[model samples]
Target chain A: MKNSFVELHARERALSLLDAKTAREIVGPLDNMISPHLEPQNIVPESDDGIVLMRGMINGNNVLVVSIEGKFQGGGIGEVSGAKIVAALEKVLEENKQGNTIYPIIVLDTGGVRLQEANYGLLSISEIQNVVIALKKYVPVIGLVPGRVGSFGGMSITASILSYLIATNKARIALNGPEVIEQEAGVREFDSSDKDLIWDTLGTKQRSKTGLVDEVVDDTVDSIKDAIVNEIKTKKDAHRTENVDFYLSLLNKLDLSKKLDIDSYNKLYQSVVATKHEVPAATAGNKEGTKSRGRLWFEKLTGIENATSSISTVLHAQKDGKEYIAIVPDSDNKFPRVREGEVGLQEGFAVASIVNKIVADDKDKTVKRPIVLVVDVPSQAYGYQEELIGIHVALGSSAAAYAKARQAGHPVIDFIPGDAVSGGFLAHGLQSNRMIALDDDSITIQAMSKASAARITQRTIAELEEATKHVPAMAYDVDNYEKLGALYKLVKGIGSWEATDENVVKIKQLINEAITSLDGDTTLHFRYQTPIAKASGRKATLAVRKLVDEEWSK
Target chain B: MEKLHFNFDTKDAISKPVHVGVVASGDLEVIFRPTDKETEVNIVTGSDGFKEVWGNVLQRFFDRYPIQADIEINDFGSTPGVVNLRLTQALEELKDEK
Candidate 1:
C-alpha cells in the first residue's frame, strides 16, 4: 500500500516463497522475457517485476496468470509489458487450440498505455486486444480490477473485449478518467470534487448499472479468487459468429420512437435523474426514492402514468406474483438480500433473456417469443454480501446467456427506463441485439452536474464548454457516442412508458428486415457490424466482406 | 539491373491507402497499392540489407498462398498487415474471375 508496486511485488514474492515448486513453476520476467520496446526508451526494466506470466496448478488444473505490477509506472502497459501479455496470450491461445488445460487470468490495475512509450505501447494494446479475441476462442480471459489506478482507456477496452470482468468497490473503469473529461469538456459537464458523482459516473456501481462490468465484489485477494473459481466452474461454450440478422432484430426491438433525437438519447443514456427525493435513482433497498431522469424521460415519451411510485408499490407488485412492470423508485436499497439457493431474475437476466430469444429465433421463424429485460437495476447489486457471493459469476452467467441467445438466432431488444450509464447499460443495455433509451428531459451523464467532471480533469466548468466546441470527445452528450460509432440509433422524441408495445413491435419489424439482409457467411463483418446493432444491413455485409478478406489471408 | 515490371488487372479500385500495423523497428509498413492485379502481390524491398533473408521469408510465405496473382511490394519497411495486403493485391490482379 505504501508503494504501488510494493503489494504487487509482495504478491509475486509470496508465490516464490510458497514453495520451491512455486519458484520453479513461476516464470519470472527475470528470465529475459522483457518487451522489445523498453530498450529503445533506454529504461532499465525489471523482468520479473513488469509482467509475471505464471503457468501454475490451481487444484490440479493448469492456469496462466498475467499480472501487471502497479509499482511499474502505476501498472501502465508499455511495449515490454504489452509484448509479454501478447506472447502469453498467443501461447495460451495456441495451447487452448491444442486442447491444453490453461485458464488465462489478467490482473488489471493500469492507467492504460504509458505515454513515455506511446507508439509501441499503443500497438501492444491492440495486440493485446487481438490476443484477447484469440484466447476467448477457447478459454475465458478473466480481468481482475481492484486496488488503485484501476483500468482506463485502452485497458478499459481490453476489459470490454475480455470474456469476463471482475471488479471490487474500489475498482473504477472508464474510457477516460474524470480529469480528462473535465479538461476536455470543462467542469460544467462534470465535477470531480463530488465523491458521489465520481463513483456514480465511473465507479464500479455505475459501470455495473450500465452493464459494462460483469460483477462487483469486495476488495480482497480471496474474494477475487473465489469469483474466478466460480466463473471457471460455470463456464459455457463459446459463440463466435458473424450474423447480423440476430443483432439487427434485437436493435429493432430497442424502440427509439421516430420522435426521439440525439440529445434525448445522451441525456437518458449517460445521465442519472433522481425522483422528487434527493436519493440516487440506482442503489437497492429504499425503493421509494425519486425516479431516474431516464425513467422520467420514459414516462414523458410514453404518456404513461407511474402506477407504482413507492417501495410499497414494489412490495404490492411482488405480493401479487404477477409479471407486471413497475417503475422502480431509486434510493439506497440493499434490503432484498439475495435469498439463499435462489437466483431471481435481475436486470442481467432480463438482458440475457432478450439475447437468448434472438438467438433461438434465428434458427426458427415460427418462434415469436417476446424477450423482456426488466429495467429496474440500480446497477448490479454492490457491497460486501454481493462480493462474498461472487457477483461477477452471477453477472457473467447472465452475459453468457446473452451470448447463447445470439448463437441461437433471436432478436433481443432493450429499453432504458432510468439510469442507463456505465456497467449497467453495458451489461443489460449494450449486450442486447439492440438498445433504445427514453427521451427523458432531466437525464444527464454525470449523476449530479458538470461539477464532477471538473475533479478528474482539473478544469473549470467554463473550460469544458470551450473545449467541447472543438473536441467531440469532450462533449458530455450521449449523442456524441452515437456519432462516434458507439451507439447505433437515437430516437428523437417520445416518453418511455407510452410506446412499450409499439416499441416492441417496431423493434421486431426492424429485426426481421435485418435478418432478411444477411447472407450465410459468419465473418468479421458480422462480428463488427451485427453485434453492435447500430450498423445497417449493408454495413454488416461490407464489414463481413472486409473482415473475411483481412482475416482469411492472415 | 532489369526492372521486371509485373502488373495485373484488379476488379475493384484500391481506394486509398489507410495503413495500419508496423513491419519492425526499421521495417514493415502496410501499404495500399492500387493496382489492376485482380488479387496478386509483388514484393520488392531494398534487399540490400536482407536479400536472402527477404527472399526466404517471401518464398515461404508465397508457398502457402494461391498463385495467379500480380503484386509489386516496394518496401521501405512494412508490417505483416502490409505484407498480407500486397499479396492480396497480387491475388486480385492475377484474377480474371469474379
Candidate 2:
C-alpha cells in the first residue's frame, strides 16, 4: 500500500518528510495561538492556524518543513497563519546566515490571501518572499505542491521564486482560479464548472511540460520525499521568474488576435528562441495615451505627458536621478483583458525587463537610483489565455525584480493614487519598502473583487460587506488599508486625479520624504514597526514573531 | 460560531499531551493536554445549538475511558460519529504513547 502525501494533513505531511523521532513542531496546535480576526467575523479559528512548522532532519540533513493545511479554510493565509510562515522563514534565514544551514521546504496548498484577513496576507506573503530571496544566498529554498488546493493566487507567485519546485500529478497551479476568472471576466472567458478544461490547463503534468512547475512526481509520500531529497542534493534552481527574455520573446510571438489553446500554446512554448529584448523607457507619444490615475501621475511626476512606451502598458522614465515606473491602462491595447490597466502578461514582463535594466545599470553605484512605482492597477488580467500562459510567472517576474532591486539597496517606493487590487497589487505595489498613497476614497486596495471574494468564501455580498466594517483588512478602501500600517504616508487633501501644479509638488515632496526616510533599510520590517501596526494592525504578527524567535533554537 | 464548555470529574490521569484531527469541512481538531485538575473540554464549533449532542458524545466517551486532561476542540460542523472517531483517535494515540 502506497502512502499518499496529499491525503495527509499539514502536520502529518511535515512529519512524514522528516526523520522519525527527530521531528519537533514549533507553534503546535496546543500552543493556543489562533487567528484573532476569524472569531470576530464569525468564522471558527483553527488551533495551529492551519500552518505546521516542523524542525528535524531530512535524511540526516537539517530541515524545516512549513506545511499549509489545505483542508482548513482552503489553506487561506490569515493574519496569524501568514505571520507564522513569515516568522518561521525569517528564523530559517537567521539560521542560514549563522552557518547552521537548515533547508526550508514549503508545502504550498494555499489560495493566496485569506479574504478574512486580506491585507495582512499580502504583507506577509511579500515578507515571506523577501526572506526566501535572502535565504537563496545561502542554500536552495525548496517548494512542494501536493495537490488538494494546490498553490494559487499570490502564493503561486511566491512559488515562482523558490530555488526548485516539485509537485505531484495530483496538484494544479495557477494565479487565479477558474471560478474567479468566470466571476471577473465572464463565463465565456472561463466556465468555472468546466473541470476538465481547468485540469488540462493547470494540472502539474501540463505545468511541467510548459515550464510552470519544474518537475512532477507520483503522489506517494516516498516519491515526494525522494524528489525533495534529490533536489537538496542537486541544488536545482529553476529560476522561473528570472526568465524575462524568454517570456518577452514568447509574448512577441503570441498573436493576440487568436484565442490561445493548449496545443498552440505548447507549440509556442517550444518555439521560443529567447532573444535579448530591451524595453525602452517611456517617452511622450505623439497622441494622448489612455487616461488613468497611474498614467496621469506618471505624466506629472516624470514630466513626460502622454507617457507611452513600446510595450504600450508599461511606462518607465528616469527623471532627476530617480527611476519612475507605472503600469497604466490602454483602452486600445491588443490584449483585451488588460485594456483597463490590469497587470497582464505583457505588463508584468515589461515591468521586470525595465526594473532589471535599472538594477543592472546601477550595479556598482553606491548611490543607487530609487525606483518609484505609480500603481493604479484594477487587478490582474483575468482570462483563459493569461492563466494558460502562466500569469503567475509574469506577476512573479516583476515582483522578484522589485524585491531584488530593494534587496540590493535600491529604495523601492509605491505611490498609489488609484486602485491596487489582487495579483496586480502583489506584482506591483506590495514589494516596496515605503508606500505613499493618497487619502482618497477612490482607491480600492484588496486581494480580490467583492463578487469573487464572496463566491470563494461562500458568503453573500452583504455578509462580506458587514464583515468589512469589523475587520480593517477585509475592507477594500484605502482608508481601511491604512489601518494595517503598511503605508509610509497617507497624504490627505489630494484627490486621485487632481494632479494640480501644487498637488504634484506636494506629492513630489512626500515621495522624497519617503525615499530619505528609508536610511538604507531594505527589509519590510517598517510595516511591523509602525505605531499602528504595533498597537493593533499587526499585533498578532508581532506576537508570532516573538514566539517563533524564542522557539527556533530549541 | 458557538462556544461550549464542559467539565467532567474523571479519575484516570492522562500521561502526556496529544493532538488529533483537522478542522476541515465536516471534521474537527481535538487537542488534549495532561492535567492534575478535573477533565475540562472547551469547544469553538461552527455549528450552533449542538450543546446536547456534544455533551452526549463526551458523556459516552468519558464513560468508556475517563481520562483526565485539558481538552480543546475547534470544530467545523463535524457529526457526532466524527466527533467520537476523533476523540477515539486521540485516545488511541494516548494508549500508544503509554
- Provide chain B TM-scores across all predictions: 0.38, 0.97
Separately for all candidates shown, the number of backbone clashes (residues 3 or more apart, or on different chains) is: 126, 0
Model 2 lDDT at residue A376: 97
The model with the greatest DockQ is 2
Per-residue lDDT tens digits of candidate 1, residues A88-169?
6666777788898678878787776554343234335645665565567688877777746777645665676676788877
- What is candidate 1's fraction of native contacts? 0.00
Query: Which ranges in model 2 have alpha carbons more than 4 Å from their true place?
Result: none
Best by TM-score: 2
Question: What TM-score do all the candidates reach, one by one?
Answer: 0.40, 0.98
**lDDT per residue, candidate 2, A1-554, as tens digits?**
37989999999999999988989989988777899899989999899999999999999999999999999998988889988988999888888888898999999999888888888888888888888888988999999999979999999999999999999888999999999999999999999899899999999988998998888888898999999999889998998988999999999899888889999999999999999989898888789998999999999999997877889999999998889999988889889999999999998998998999999999999989999999999999999999999999999999999999999999999999999898999899899999999999989999998999999999999999999999999999999999998889999989999999999999888889999999989999999999988998889999999999888887
Model 2 chain A scores worst on lDDT over the 10 consecutive residues at A1-10
DockQ of 2: 0.83
Find the 10 residues in a row with the least total lDDT in model 1 chain A.
A315-324
